[model samples]
Target: MAIKLEKVVETFYQKLEEGKIMGKKCTKCGAVEFPPVYACNSCGCWDMEWVEISGKAKMHSIVMPAPLSTKPEYKNLGKYAYGEIELEEGSRFNGVVRGMTKKKRKEILAAGKLPVPCHAAIYQRDGYKTVVFDLDEE
Candidate 1:
C-alpha cells in the first residue's frame, strides 16, 4: 500500500513540474480525488486514472493558522489560511490559500461570501513544487 501510494505522489509531482495539476478519477464512480489519492473516497474504489484538473476552485471555509503552531516550511508563504476547497471538477479538499488575513476573513464572512472564487497555483519550494490557492480579486 505504501509503494502504491508513493507512485501516486511521484506522478502528481511530475505533473506539477510540467505546470499541470492532476487528480485521480475513479473509473467506476466518476469521482475525482485531488492530491491524487489511489482510491476513490466516494465509493471506495481502487480503479482510478490520472486526470488534469482545471485549477479552478472555490473557498468554502477559512481558518487562520495559529502563529505558534505554524510550520517552518510555510514561513515563505507569507499570509495564508487553511480552507476547505472545492475544485471545479467536483473534488473537495483542504488546501492552503494565499493572501489571507484576519481582517479579510472577517469582511468576507460579514459580507456573507462564504464561498469565494479562487484558483490553484503551483509554488516552488526549496527543492520541489506544491500546489496552493489564491483568492480571485473582485
Candidate 2:
C-alpha cells in the first residue's frame, strides 16, 4: 500500500504541534530525510521510519531576503534570512534562519565561519508551528 503524500505532510505538522521534531530514516541505507518524506532520497528506498531529530544543524550559506520578494506573513520574523542548513542527520535544505542582520552576516563572513553552529527553533505562525534556525552563541 502506497502512503499518500498529504498524509506524510499532515503527520509532520502533527508531530511538530506535539513539540517533537520528526524525520524519516531509511532502513536500507541509514539516510534520514528531514521534512519527513515517505521515500528516501538516498539509495531509492521506501522503507523509512520516523525518528526524532536532535534539532541541531549548521548554517552553510546565507542569502538575505529581497525587499520586494519578502512575504507579508513573514514580516513578524524581523532580521531573518534564507540559508542553506545542514541537519545533524546529514540532510541539507534551504530554511529560514532568524536573528540575522547585515552586520552579523558580515561578521560571520569576515571571521571565516562558513558553517556556524545553529539549533532548530519551533516558531508558531498563524495557526501552525514551523521550524527555523537560530545561530548558536557558543
Q: Which stretches of candidate 2 lie over 4 Å from their true place?
A: 1-3
Q: What is the TM-score of each candidate against the true structure?
A: 0.96, 0.95
lDDT of each: 0.95, 0.91
lDDT of 1 by residue, 96-133 (tens): 99999999999999999999999999999889999999
For 1-138, candidate 2 gives per-residue lDDT tens digits of: 355888888888999999988999999999999878888998989989999999899999989999999988788878899999999999999999999988899999999998999999888899899999999986
**Any idea what lDDT model 1 has?**
0.95
Q: Model 1 Cα displacement at 79 (Å)?
A: 0.7
Leading candidate by lDDT:
1
Residue 89 error for model 1, in Å?
Answer: 1.2
Q: What TM-score does structure 2 among the candidates reach? A: 0.95
Q: Listing every candidate in turn, what is its Cα RMSD in Å to the true structure after a full C-alpha superposition?
A: 0.9, 1.5
Off by over 4 Å in 1: none
TM-score of 1: 0.96
Candidate achieving the largest TM-score = 1
Q: With candidate 1 superimposed using the best TM-score fit, by how many Å does residue 3's alpha carbon deviate from the native?
A: 0.9
